[model samples]
Target: MNDRLTAAQASRSTAVKATLDYPVIDTDVHVNDYTPALEEYVQQYGGGELVDALRKVLGSRFNTRSNGKDWYQQTLAERRYNRTLRSPWWARVTRNTLDLATYTLPALLAERLAEQGADYSVLFPNDVLAPLGAGRHRQALHRAINHYHADQYSKYSDRLTPVAGIPLHTPEEGIEELEFAVKTLGLKVINIAGGVKRPIPSVADKYPAADHPEVAKYAHYTDFYGIDSEYDYDPFWAKVVELGVPVTTHYGSQGWTGRHSISNYMYNHIGHFADGSQAFAKALFFGGVTRRFPGLRVALLEGGADWGAHVFTHLLDRWDKRNREAVHNYNPANADLELLENLFQRYGKDLIKDRTLDKSTLLLDSLGVSALPHSRDPNEDEIDDFALAGIESPEDIKTRWVDSFYFGSESDDRTVASAFNAKLNPLNAKINAIWSSDIGHWDVPDLTEPLAESWDLVEQGVITAADFKALVFDNPYRFYTEANPQFFKGTAIEQKLSSSHTK
Candidate 1:
């Protein structure tokens, strides 16, 4: 055994696992991409044209080439003109070469996961762009990538299971790949991009991004399937439900709105996964995807548990203040115009000194409820925002948000406490927080420390021993089983659970 692997076996994480009666499942271990092998597989399956397309992956958070020039090659003038958002550089572990090699080689990873105190791991490929990027050749590339993963890692399936990536730029493409990946490939877990970038109508009309890529980047919006999407996507969701695989996303919002930092990668990087997942998850809630499909089991990964807990509490709070009945409290048509005029007249003088009160429009604008005078009443279908969600009470919010959605969290995020805090969360429901030890990435310098650090939460009184069990085991098991009850069958986790039950 390598020195590092030996040391890892003797680490505290393994010690912590020794104390546990249940198995430890690491849901989000990443496999660093060996691009040359991937390229070879693409060349074989997709041919040279698609292989060349795969080679042009810009190595950004997603896989779009910036027209011609790479980011570093750009002159300041070009950067200012094109406005390229910062991308990740030097993202993998280097000094600990063996640890890096362990994840890259499935056999080594399978051998070492026990040292990391994990009984089984679901491997998300480090290169997500090929399976989730937009292009003519993407469907072929996605197939080639998933095929390569299935071929390369099947032997290690006893301990290490690689997740298949399904591109959802269109419902047709998503359904095609989903059928192929699950039915043909026999892959269980699936990773999906949270959203797809679509060109704005006016911007694309004049400067079509197909002709000018800059126009697409600068003038675009994301379509997160569940809300404001061009496609209904119910068929894709239904197919997922029919197949019984859990949905996992490692989506990043690197260049979106406030995160578009032209100078610093860190500014664009932090909380990006959380932000992207938040938008996608929130879209599912408000767009009524969860309400419509009660069997859907969605997990938003890498973003911490704190964000999930916050979203759950906030959902209940919003429902409390903005549900169908409560929203009418501030309806403009119901406003007491006489009382407002009296109060403004009494407290006014300075405010009214500037505008004429004869202008009821200007007076009402100053009073802060000025979108009205009946430009048009909303259609009956659009009356209540929460109508689609079917949220009659906070319990419904708990069922939809808390029960259906799972948050993929790292070990050291202090906010695991918030996810477990039933006292603070509305309706005393614990937000599902699953441990996804992003071991191969830069954040976790040591491979074996994640499980140990999670145990530290119990020692620090951040959560109970029961909460730690839920974080590392129960919640993740439930998430994996919610859609497909047979998700863990024949796997190492199933054997471990069966052994515990038999004992």
Candidate 2:
């Protein structure tokens, strides 16, 4: 035999060296959305009109800006630019389109996983998520894409688990899709968009008037922070808890309105996932969804764990100061009008002569007596404020914010170590940092890089081996298995998990 070893052999050797007692489960791996049979599924689900709509909606020139592009007569260069932008850098670097086989081929992907020493991976769709939108065709679109995703991983279910995409524009639709995907499709994990679009004037009022000026073709999508959301969405959360599938959001703020600078993709990409996940987590916590659905688990995918740590501390900081009781201190009613008047008269005799300081205008317009705090009880209105939902102590924040949510961190992220830092997190508690390799995407050049990069934390003394184990394996295991204890029942690591539990 030759003394030389293949690249796969070398990667396998490296993975063996870094092996942990627990199996590594990557929570956010992506799969290619463009299958040869995608259109077939679309047609089968009565999404022929949606296919026509998609064909009519011309693709964006910039990969960063996808919404509201002219649907007709797009230039060839624009299409070429978008396609080039979306392709992986490795393919460009190697100048070989076949490098994509690592993602496209199930055998190759499994080999790569074995080389990385990862026991399992949860697959997400990149392009499919964008098209799974709301409206008349939502159910059909959701069904088709979910069916395709299930088919993609059907044979590879031993090592790969595809997350079922469920739309949340309506609770009834969301519930129906969840049930169908889990029961009929036999999908174990479910993924949903962290945010929703608030159709202005509600879907009911807008539908009656098709030609109305207010009725735009696209609904004004907003962050679901619950501060301004039109829907309660408690029923959806209840369904998630009822079904035993841990909910994950691969949603990000990539091609949205604010991030729509046509110049640079990096400008739109930085911290986009973090922003989306933070908004969703905050909405769930402040809206009292977590309090109501205590058993519910949410994993914010592709965002680093640092956001989780920051958002948790930030919420407490805001809650400590922004409560109705604390805000009452700043009530305009508390301002002494008489004292201010005396000071104004003493300090501004020249201004009075010039008619600069108008007392009536100042009181009526600037600090109106009619809008005083005494006019309405703060306690009575406190119930209306979603942020003040029975939030008495740190326990509430810890339970609702910390325990209920898990952060999906890519292996290549340096900030992954921060999730394990007790000092950075609140109450010396750790945020659940689930390992998400994102192997098929541009961020990871090599399929094996994610696991190797994550081990850098251990080599740098950023985290202990035990901490790294939790980051890669324990946290992911807990996130999924806690929702459905039989999550790994037939998987490769069921024995190891069982042994650990027995011990």
lDDT of each: 0.84, 0.71
Candidate 1 segments whose C-alpha is farther than 4 A from its true place: 1-4, 7-9, 58-67, 75-78, 338-374, 377-380
Q: Candidate 2: list runs displaced more than 4 Å.
A: 1-8, 12-18, 47-99, 202-219, 223-227, 255-257, 335-379, 382-388, 499-503
lDDT of 1 by residue, 1-503 (tens): 34445553488888998899999889998887687888899999868887777766534434223557766777767777767766777787877888889867877888887789999889888875454553777788888888889888889777777888888888898899989998998888899989988888988899987798656667888899986788899999999999998999998888888887667889999999999999999888888889888999999999998898898888878878888788877666666778777887789898789866654564458655545556676664666788878889888888888888999989898887999898988788888999989998999888989999999989999999999999999999999898999888888998888888897
lDDT of 2 by residue, 374-415 (tens): 756555466334354467776688888888899988876888
- Model 1, residue 276: distance off in Å is 0.5
